[model samples]
Target: MNSKPVTRIKKINMYKISIIGYGNLGFHLVNHLSETGHKITQVFTRDKTKTRISKNKIDFIDDLELLRTDADVYFLPVKDDALKEVAKQLSLKGKIVAHCSASVEMKVLKNCTENFGVFYPLQSFSREVEVDFKNIPILIEGVNKETSSVLNDIAASLSNEVIEVNQEQRLAVHVAAVFANNFSNYLFSVAEEILKKENISYKILLPLIEETVRKVKEHAPSKSQTGPAKREDDKTIQKHLKFLSNKKELKNLYTIITDQIKSKK
Candidate 1:
């Protein structure tokens, strides 16, 4: 003991992070943060059946009672429905807690802790797909200046874009996301069904889909608009509507969407 000198622990830029949930977003945050030099001290999940933590040596806790509250930042990337319930179960006190829900505000975590924030990553996450967060926009909001700085540092370390957006702005962005992503995907599904009925592969529309997306990237979506609705072609519209006549919902959806599109033009 006398021969060996005491070595002090380095407290520079590194932060201890405790990630909650084991979903796609949670996996992304854990993997990306670990890759970017942040210390993931704990991983909390509901299901521990398929969880594998080989990249880093971290404490994995599935049970709520066993969750560690010692980390500098605790990330809650769980579903919106599970957020409040988890918050109720956990007693974080003064720890910095954050959630990834697009709709819910940071107030949801008030019961869990006095210091809380929203660490919303504004993009879809998939475990099977590799994500490059270099240019991804991470929306952040905090209960106070201290919480904001902590979240900002963590976000800035891994992402090229970091925005401090309030609840109203975040909700608007989320609604727009649903329109740009989910609604379009649903329309693609409908298109696929129509093509399948005619023994035509959906691959035929792939180029069209890609080009449409590209056009919006280059210019405004309103300016990039095309097709029957944009041109107000009643003949083509009626023809398409008649084809979907057998399905009442589909027909009504087609009419409503066409009307809305035409009105926009």
Candidate 2:
């Protein structure tokens, strides 16, 4: 509920940290933490070649067992499918182990050790894109008090908007995120294809897309809703459907989303 920037009122001594899966979120986290005087001792990735190097010069390891055994904290940023297996293999009795998964329950890491938690970053991560951790909201949940404080501290160090979210709430948020981010991006892909087929520049939609996002920031998304569907303009909706007759899938999506919006209204 505190909408203030991450405040490091008291600096904790740098704990030796290792990140599993040196992908997008992991890469950004390492870079962000490294700049904040946190020591990144090692990085683990299945594909060591793709990992980027920051000034701290992290040592990359391919084998999970060979990772620095003395690491005080281990961040598992790996995919959902690999989380349990990795946790099972790792001997983290005394280490603080946290994962970045939104859907997976904290209990999945029970196989690893009692000191486990969720350190979910509620943002879309892409290797090609640069992320600003200051703006990204972090959701953290720890199995124990000590682990929770440590994870909360780590999250607070990276982002201003850090909150303690339980597994149920985090999973619900993940579902909403799928609709808001993934499905919306898929709609843009549909728009891009439509423009490509009609020999129009996709750049033309940039302003409208940007404005939609901007408006949502200022107003509730439902209240900021516009277009034929929001207004229940059947004539305009029919016209738009006619324009999309060639794309069956897109037309269906438009119809379904429009119907849902109308029903909500």
Candidate 3:
């Protein structure tokens, strides 16, 4: 009797990628992409000297002229305001060009390539902080089905949560994120400022913040609401407004938010 040999299948297909920005999102994308066995051919930044040293030996270039055209995907993780201008310089006709902006439309890359799309990560990114790529929701939008499939495969390789979203849907998610993440963070900063004025440590709010987030995770934010505004506690709300009286801007902001919260209830 003769024995048959077995063959192994590669789960993730390797892609050659070129990142056009070295900012926070770009930095993390580069690290994760490289770690996932993708070959980063080049990385572009305004000033390569200012960026942290690359351990992946990625060719960092300042000039767009130096950009290599060999990569399969060109990732533009630049600021939303500068995404268009930076993309205008690229002339990769057949290669896939993608932007990581939550607000920007995918049509911005229409003229750049035939296979252009968006590879937006839902979570906020910062250069100093470390995050797990697998946990983040990657929202992908391609010009067509074939283009979308390619992006979907790539996004799946990086994240456990991958969704195929259209421009309109992506914009909706972005707006919701602004409310949930950015607005909440700003409120946290306001809380910190209030504590600072009273010579109290902002760390005192950490446990409360954590518990609030935990409750929201298990239930809808509306269902988890337990604040003075949510409870319609006019006395406490008035007291808070009185405390913020010296800071007219804060008082106005508080009033606006309190009214909004109460209205939602």
Task: Note the Cα lDDT for every prediction shown.
Answer: 0.87, 0.86, 0.89
Q: What is the TM-score of each candidate against the true structure?
A: 0.90, 0.90, 0.90
List candidate 1 segments past 4 Å from native. Answer: 1-12
Query: How would you order the candidates by lDDT, starting with the best?
Result: 3, 1, 2
- RMSD values, in order shown: 6.8, 4.6, 3.4
* Candidate 1 to truth, TM: 0.90
Per lDDT, the best of the predicted structures is 3
> Worst ten-residue run, lDDT, model 3?
47-56
Which runs in model 3 stand beyond 4 Å of their true positions? Answer: 1-10, 50-52
**Per-residue lDDT tens digits of candidate 3, residues 21-40?**
99888899899999998889
Write model 1 residue lDDT over 149-214, tens digit each, in one string: 899888888788999999999999999999999999999998899889999999999999999988
lDDT value, candidate 2, whole model: 0.86
Clashing pairs in 2: none
Q: Which stretches of candidate 2 lie over 4 Å from their true place?
A: 1-13, 51-54
